[model samples]
Target chain A: MADRAAVPQAPELTARRRSGLPRAASPAVVLAMLAIATLAAVVLFMTLDLRGNLGYVLPRRAVKVAAMLLVAVAVGLSTLMFQTVTANRILTPSIMGFDSLYLFIQTALVFAVGGSTLATAPVVGKFAAEVLLMVLFSGLLYRWLFTGGARSLHLMLLVGIVLGTLFRGGSSLLQRLMDPSEYIILQDLFFASFNQVDPALLWASAAVVGAIAAAAWRLRHTLDVLALGRDTAVNLGVDHRRVVSWVLLMCSVLVAVSTALVGPVTFFGLLVVSLGYQLCREYSHRWLLPIVGLLGAVALIGGQLVLEQVFGFDTALSIIIEFAGGILFLFLLLKGSLK
Target chain B: MIRLSGVCKSYGTARVVDQVSAEIPSEGVTSIIGPNGAGKSTLLSLISRLQPMDAGSVAVGGLDVAATGSRELARTMAILRQENHLTMRLKVRDLVAFGRFPHSGGRPTAEDRGHIEYALEQLDLLTLADRFVDELSGGQRQRAFIAMVLAQDTGYLLLDEPLNNLDMKHSVEMMRLLRRLADELGKTVVVVIHDINFASCYSDTILAMRGGRLLHQGTPGQIMQPEVLREVYDIDIRIEEIDGNRIGVYFA
Candidate 1:
């Protein structure tokens, strides 16, 4: 029996090899390539032009790189988890109103308490409050939708889109009514920028993202099972509802960290995750999460470098990413690959 | 043995599986048969704990399914639903390797690999082991899913419409394989099958359900009568003896 089983696999293996299609690169090789690229981008971004005082230029560059890397990890990990939980490649935490919620909170605070007082508030406290609010809102939504039983993915997506539109509309209305000076401050918060990231807020974001990353690493295997869909995962002994709830909670926290740190990034996560899926052949989260993280780092650091060096800061990195990501979204929709 | 007492399930105002109570004995092939909307699949889901009961309880191998941990229940009973759709790309070997998750927790040991190879051989899937599951034909994909459940290596197996997409040759082969697993390995196999003739020929016990209740439960000789099948299906089905096996003729 063993000999017969062994015999058939060999011919098929040889047949596949003889075929003209190029074999996929192994996950390890892909990971190594991405890691090297990310490192090169970081090095180039940090030391490409080293004129002026070393102390002033070096520390500022370090802070900017740190902020970019943090956002990359935060956005990449969160988007991957969100796609797994929702079982759709097209969905991301940002699309589900997470960034818009952050925008709404900023707008609301400016509308209610005046922009000067908000800016004067202690940075850590304000960051903590924003993080807490985002987490609580996501927690309540996940608990309500998933705890009782399995809810349709369509229903969840619908709710997310509706809420996202509501937040965006509410923020715009507030901005329309606010004082011109306050609106200017609010405008700065609307566009995602790695510059001007508070050093203290960066530390807090790192701690939160680090703790969540550690937790998510332990669930790497379970996440693979989850990608099989709810019934199959449950049959394999996964507490489907509980695991999904926890994953959503982790995604919300990661999104909160990234959004709070660098303002709202609408399609950066979508772009990173989509590219990661195309480049990596493996389905396991153990490989996928890191590949995605490295991919995000490379995209951000590399894009920022190109924008600064090649374009001379003519445009923001987020605009280019969102443009490409938005086109891909439309392509995926037209292709009907949402499955 | 799997026992259900006063198990009930409802969707809104519609009762899907109402007060279903039956004991499925171990060490044989048992088949559940009924017309559409008869709750055959729903009853199987309730027993597997894939769907929670609206009212009563289910016990599998003397363990309360609700109270036991999901992993423990998984080691004892494995179920396959009617439709299995995967959104990600996965090789056939990788899909089957998931069956070992209950035991190996995603890290397959040597023994787990042995079982996986055995299942692949049993399902005649070794030739397609390297192929992507999404690229396979419908019948081949169905067999791949069956191979996955077989690799689970549980004491009890529950399958809903396992032969839905299979051709006649593969369907008979599948039934014969299930019979051999029950007779030779002492596995308790339960299937929700649509073809009454296959159920009658292969199953030691036949359960006929109608309108969310078990209308009849007996051996093939007892439940294959035209009257019993008529009451369950709301149509006349003639039973014929062929090769000493009861076969139902429902066409025409």
Candidate 2:
């Protein structure tokens, strides 16, 4: 201790200089760039080769763009928050069987009621019921897993995978036993598509996603602390269990909304979040959240434009996005950067 | 000051920390030393409120740890575990800045910056503040973590095995730093240490445990004898007086 006192002190300015190492672009700049690109994609998608009845074509395109934006925000925010709470970069809500559970709920409803009644059911009532069920299920899962003794990541992954398989198996079994016509309707519901979003359902989902995003925004700083892992977050005075429960609840709602709107885009969130981390290179959620949203928007709308204009609507946007995202997932796994 | 009364913890059928009651006075270096699985770390965790006790009460500065809000307890005490595995990339300065979260709520004020700089200087990490934590060696990483806890600016500092992975020289430096913190800042520094010699040399009070119970608690001179140490560790350790500090020779 005495020897420490004898060590000569360097000037404070030099200490500051030492911290000024070269770094990636500032988070604000990256966010601006992403926002501009997203805007460009939206504009190009809306206006490319505008023709025919102005009111008809414009309203159709506007609805498609709105659906894309809502799903982008929902998926991007949910995936980022899920990864933060779980403290694993490779895991997403979809990978943990969230969408499968959603599909299970939808399939069970259709099986219980004939396809005609299910299709005739009030859209608002069905949407609310689905979102509530997803939220409740996730809340229960988080409470059981996180509140007790320490839980290993492997155990979590295994449980998620098992539950996902169970749900998928149950859905397929029900589908196999259903009427052939009903089975066709259920099959259409399973694949992700943006072509047939009901305008009323779109508005309700937007409202839900908007309210949740506002709540999540207030928790940005807490999210950053959460990314540090549970023990450290607890040491830093965070109510680890309560905050995690709330975040997980929000994630479930977001996933439900997005899956209800565009069906299950398994790898889309992974791609958006991975690209956000690579571009921003910062751990703070204040910037990462927006960057992820913009990136998701860009990928969705831009890919839609390419598919419509170049491929002449020959391929679905979700399939292409999932294909790219799945490859990135494999790349990340092979590179051993899960940490 | 930390007071424990009837503190107990167990995993399934095995009681890791039996009904252990003791008082650690404020503002000194107190080292809890014992053999492996002797419940030293468990006791520390109970006091820090890191783990819920099966049965017991811990009061720091007269505030009941269990009854108090986590944020209030955080303002009064800070604990560091042995292994800290971070999942994200963070610079040394950024990691240390997180210590201020209890006070700043993720937004650093000018006073917080002052605290951070003071902590960085005390840990001799000013030059390495820009480096990523993953880029650091084991000793450097340990120092960075200590610096983060130091920046928390709490009156009580609790560390479990602070010298677990350090070399001889780094371990000595860490012990000295703890000593200086206790002496200069008047902080109540409680450390669960494995090295009996370091405990005997640096700690003002030494608490010895064996078999999930605290066997002895006293000054270095009172607790450094061969019989007391043998009882605590189940090994014979000869105590030598070196420059008025009690040194233990345990090597056969």
Candidate 3:
């Protein structure tokens, strides 16, 4: 009777396929777009003829572009990893307050040593100190939470937000007490600026990012499983604790590297990652991760290039990017779409 | 066969699953029935090695669950919990494809696709395979998760409250599917169930637990009696035969 009528015809599969976009287009299109974006960034950065002396402008822009790309990749990958591990779409690595901790250290250093002494401090030494301190703070927090099994991801997120507030409070108090001259130096470290990057730290950051990427590539398959959440992931043969720890460690190193490189850019990763997911519908990390990495590079490099070429460097690119990203975050939050 | 020897789990000073020991039959639907907080879910978690037991050993198919490699263990046994709060927006088909992870390790082959399709068809999710899991109704989502576990195609399936959010029709479909998996495919099915009638009608055996202890274990015929039901659930349940199936009715 009704059962016979419910026997769907072959055409139904086609109807079902129409509702969702064909999976075939996702990986290929996303990869092609990423490849094109990467190529465009490199070509534009290298061969945008300008009136400035080639000797000075060429090397300087190259370093700045490299710094932006590194920050983009590192932040993008870390945010993705954070969301995967915590199993929350809206949770970013910044929710864990790594960037605020970085700020706190910078403020404390200035407060302790005074601004004059801080400026004269070797650039290499300062960068290394920042990276080391960032890693130590994140490592201690994540390792404890991951191993304890008592703290849920929600609890960790709340704790991290509170910690961030505390750090910001401490930094603000220190800033108020510090002389105006020292405040200026510390302020430069607050907003992400590509122009102020230390060339000496570039090689070290490159090595760190490469090593983390290699580690992440090895565990990419496990990350797909990890995205299924803790219990299911464990059932599916993923060593849940070990894999989560490794991912968090890699995230820590990446965050430390990027934070040290171009300073902290809070919403940049969120902007690129949300765009990456829309660009690629597939859940496979093999495609998703790299697409995210490239999208990040494109956002930074392309945005910087446009700012320089089109706008003639009237304003810093971070201000524009931060403004746009901040608005996007608010939009996502207000629309209740970040879950 | 799955065996738990003196299994005990605790959080801080409180014993959640106190020194419980039991052996589960190797095949068919074995229902662990209990009131809330009876440690049925905890026991299932320990058996599947999802949660580490404080002081006990569990073995499935002659392999020590704690000592065996997780990937190796995954090939042999699969588990489904009630809550599936996935952060990723995965299609139903893609989520089911993950069932072959233990065998294919995230690389789906032709055989994996066949398994995924079969699972989808079995759970009546073929039409909804392309839809995001979050977009489905509660029953549809439950079926989607069951499809994922069924696609795993392991020797053993441990399900914790598979019928949690399912409606009448879907719950019956789920039970029938479990029965078929056990009867036709020879899979070992262990489920933590709350509804006594579903357990009495569909399960081959019933293991009743109360106050973190194994209250009773026997064939459904033995455990479905009025007295046993009263002892386990502290409710006046009348067992009546419906088409030769013992149906327990607990309502006034």
Task: Please provide, for model 3 over A1-339, each residue's C-alpha lDDT reduced to its tens digit, 9 standing for 90 to 100.
Answer: 887777775469777776645343668776786789788887888788655788988888789888887888899999888777767666677767878887888899889989899788887787778777777777777766764443455577678789889889999999999999899988887777888888888888888888887777777888888888888898899888888877887887788788777778777888888787777878778987888899899888888888888998899877887798888878876777544
The best candidate in terms of DockQ: 1
- Provide the global lDDT of candidate 2 against the true structure: 0.89
Evaluated at residue B13, the lDDT of candidate 3 is: 82
The runs of at least 3 residues in candidate 2 whose Cα sits more than 4 Å from the true structure, single-residue gaps closed, are A1-23, A147-149
Q: Second chain only: TM-score per model?
A: 0.99, 0.98, 0.98
lDDT of 3: 0.85
lDDT of 3 at A129: 82
* Cα error of candidate 3 at position B92, Å: 1.7
- In candidate 3, the residue pairs with backbone N, CA or C atoms under 3 Å apart (3 or more residues apart, or in different chains) clash, namely none
Candidate 1 chain B weakest ten by summed lDDT: B83-92
**Which stretches of model 3 miss by more than 4 angstroms?**
A1-25, A106-129, A146-156, A171-187, A310-312, A337-339, B11-14
User: lDDT tens digits, residues A190-264, model 1?
Assistant: 778888888898888889989998888999999999888788888899988889889988998888888878887
**lDDT, candidate 2, residue A190?**
85
What are the candidates' C-alpha RMSDs?
6.8, 8.3, 7.1
Each model's iRMS: 0.7, 0.9, 0.9
